[model samples]
Target: MANLLIIDTATESCSVALKYDDQVYTRSEIAPRMHGELVLPMVEAVLAEAGIKLTQLDAIAYGQGPGAFTGIRICISVVQGLAFGADLPVIGISSLQALAQGLYQDKKQARVLAAIDARMGEVYWGQYEVDANGLMKLLDQERVCSPEFVTISDPDTSIVYSAVGTGWSTYAKVLSETLNVPTVIHDKPLYPFAEYMIPMAEYLYISGESYAAELAVPVYLRDDVAKKAKDL
Candidate 1:
């Protein structure tokens, strides 16, 4: 049984969860700009509900960046502090990947184009393909670009894919024109949820992707020096 704690405040959603054995306990809210206030309490609530202590966690996992700057930092800072005090390891899962995982169902293989509304009329995007065995692999690295930027650079666009994340929803017309494929979209699944963060964190833990608390870092597409408030 792996005891894993997960959090995602990289988007408007503030969510936390604990995974023990085959059971999951989660707390989530779609309150934008409330990540700092809500994440820690949600974490505490989930931990308490599961009867697990911080030190018992095998790893602390977080949805690391490519979303709200302040929101991402809030989650990473908390995870770092908790993991450091507890002497636990950490895994940094991409917010985009977490969004992709949320689209998974038992019915069929999942092909997802996960992106976040990066504001400034641009987006942070990636492609993911999940196999029948329930393993998701990134088909593309995370990138930031305009919604007009299509992902399919090749001609073999044959997979039945789902367009997910707020980026797609917000810029649907631009994305649809860009991708040219008739996309099956779930507008609500764009944000990362705590529930999707656990299994991936567990897998990374088993695979030794875990790092010391201080080593965990969020990924921001725009360098601080390059970003202007006008972009936000």
Candidate 2:
């Protein structure tokens, strides 16, 4: 297995994971507004436990957006600095996909409706299903909209879905009324975890999808909305 390090501060959770010697070491905490303080320490702790420096890793990965703007910025900037300093390539994993991957990791759920509370009376949403390779594959474009506007692009009645992330906690009734599909809602794992991102990151790295540190970017689904609001 290739050595890799992953970081995520996309939601209230701040997490870091390092893969070394085919073993994974992780640190995570659900501490909102404290991500800036917690993330680097967590990274240090995991690298220490893994007994390797950042330069030893094949690539670095980070949760790339559809989350709190500041949190996403913090994650991307940190990863950029670390990867640039180490001369390592970086991979950007979707925060929504990470949430879906978390559910798959814990419950082996094949179909997941992942959403993150985007605030401003909206949610960042995506539909994901496990592929033949056992990786969560996004079925449609991820979007940010009000709870009532959330949808499943193509519904499969034979398949039951799993719901995850903070959005469900805040808008379950609305989403339930909107989706019109059988879904088991999960109360835990309300935020993306770096540990779950490792598989996707490793796959991306092996596929030659990794990019330079300067290319690391955050994906805030509501950029247009934010710009409009700023103009107002």
Specify the highest-TM-score model's number: 2
RMSD of each: 2.9, 2.1
Instruction: Quote each prediction's TM-score.
Output: 0.91, 0.95
Which numbered prediction scores highest in lDDT against the true structure?
Answer: 2
lDDT of 2 at 160: 83
Q: Candidate 2 lDDT, tens digit per residue, 202-225?
A: 898888999999988788888784
What is the C-alpha lDDT profile of model 1 across 83-156, one tens digit per residue? Answer: 88899898999888888887874224377778899988889998888866475678857888888875753424
Give candidate 2's whole-model lDDT. 0.91
Candidate 2, position 63, lDDT: 96
